[model samples]
Target: MFTSDYKYKDYIQEIYKTFSPLSWLLKIFSLDSLSRGNKQKFASSYWALAKGALTFTILAAINLFTIYYKFTWFYVELIISVKYADAVQMIYDLCQYFVDLYFVYKYGSDVFYEYIRQYAYIDGMFGMEYYGSIRRRLINVMIFMISMWFSSSLSDYVIWAIGFGLMSTTFFSMAYIYMFIKILTNLHVTVHIMHIESRLRVLGDLIQECYCSSVSCTARIEDAVIKKNWFYTIKTKTSKSQLYPLKKISYVNSNEVKWLSRCYLLLTEQVNFINRMFGMRPVTAPCWTKGLSQGEGLPIITTLGRRDGYRTRYEKMQAAYKDLLSLVQSQPINFHMAHFMRLDYPLLVSICSVFVTYTIILIQSI
Candidate 1:
């Protein structure tokens, strides 16, 4: 429903068109195919093996040189560079690349693997294809960011890319290298989102099951009790002292009801936590009925609260549960916003503004 403005199928086609051919060569270890979970064989088939081996042999010389330059000679170049700041930047870039590489290899792939599993497992409560679309867009954004690093590396390290008359060979050569960096880093974040959603979905399913089972069992017990009371009235005495019609018509255990209510409240709390994290405005059912009432756990009781009060409590909890489902269905996904947890957009802007201000001061002082 939220994808009305987004053309997912078109973008999926674009991804296939752009990446299908070189996927084998690009994912030397089949990481891309592995990341997709299933139904793709671009990485491990006989043709993929033959083509990847042939291409690696073809690019072996340059690949060797590039790897050595990145891990070793780049740092050595850093110490000798005249512009220390940009040199430091190159160091940071390489470090970010390595750290992101480790994260992607170790957790990112597992995350996507689990994401696909959970998406299918939960029958697609996975929400917006944040796994697919945002990941691609985030990689695009990071590729733009990488351009900054590449430009600095060219000016500072003088190795990653070098210019020629009309075009640069190094620039073309390292395109896949940077693209690899972008994919890994973006997937790292994508996997994290998937993992969290997977856990939340599991918890939600458990709570729903409990709610169903408990409510059904209570209904059966209440039915049996009412029948026994009717038989007693027919067989025995009915006097003014005897309350013959009085039977426990409702056997919804108070503990079970309250526990479910608490579960519902906790579910909403978690949903709001994720919403807050993603910079989404709270899906407030009046901020959880005014935080379960003013200051304490109990609301101030008024005489008007006399009409089927348990039903009102049940309705509130039920609303919270449904709201959690809707929030899950919406799946907040803003790349810049998602990147910063515990800090909303205003705070992020303020931090950036302050940093820029201080940088200007330091530059003027220099």
Candidate 2:
């Protein structure tokens, strides 16, 4: 009697379907919006996508034709060796593997080119913004998701291995590209900072030159000058040098110092935020953690200046930009790769594993 009781499960499913009118309508609308929203951008993105698909299709057809032509003798030989069916099957599997690899390589290249087109111009000229960097990866991410969804096969092991391989390659490449972008952006940002310093020095000199006849000050204010960094040397016609200590800001008094501290703190936060976005801990967080954790008397990983040392260290450089972002806020949006291109050890290691596995599979197939 219990074995024949299908009514219970059917009743439960029916009950689940019996939501109130308002809830049903709400669910329908939500689903509709989601479905529509997802494809909204595809209308425009599709044209280029179609051209890419067509090109790939032509290439694949040509490749297939050529391979068949060249391997015609092998196919005849395999047909003659009817007892070696397993070996023939392996050869077929090997050909399929190469075909899959070709598609992956083609798709990855297209997506990467699209990224370059969208970001290379502006990011090349100006430094990338925190969020801007990660947003750049959205296309590649979408491609990865789509590939994973469509690439599933009847063989779970092969599917898993291949899927993992493609994903690993995608993320590893993304992380590498992001690191390259970060280094380049940082270098450019540093150059821009140097330019700002030079302009400030020039302005200070012009001020002294224009106001020399109006003021009766004789002793140079070199001693009064605030130092920001060691490499940041500000010199004048009077042979007086304004020394800036490492990571210090040139400010007038205690108030400026406080302001600079806050500004630097914010910049530190931004850098850390970007690092976190890219899966790295901010260098400043340890310091913030160190002070707080010490006060609280806790022995957590949050402690700053740990003997083990933190992974990322951009607080000193980014601190200068904290106060400067007010200007950035008013400017048009900028893109950066600092936030998007992060991959953890798990991700990195897994990717390598996937590649090795994929290589082995390919070799076996061949």
Highest TM-score among the candidates is held by which one? 1
Predictions: Cα RMSD each = 17.5, 22.4
- Please provide TM-scores, in order, for all candidate models, with all chains considered together: 0.34, 0.23
What is the Cα-based TM-score of model 1?
0.34
Single out the weakest 10-residue window by summed lDDT for candidate 1. Answer: 295-304
lDDT of predicted model 2 = 0.31
lDDT on C-alpha atoms for all candidate structures: 0.37, 0.31
lDDT of 1 by residue, 1-366 (tens): 113223433333333433333334336633344423344313334443354345444444544555455446344643333334433444444444443333333333334344333333222222222234434554575566657666764564344334333123352345445445544434333433443343333333233332333343354444222222232112221111111113422333344334434433444444344333223221111121112121211111111121122243356544544444444334332222222343434766599679979975764454
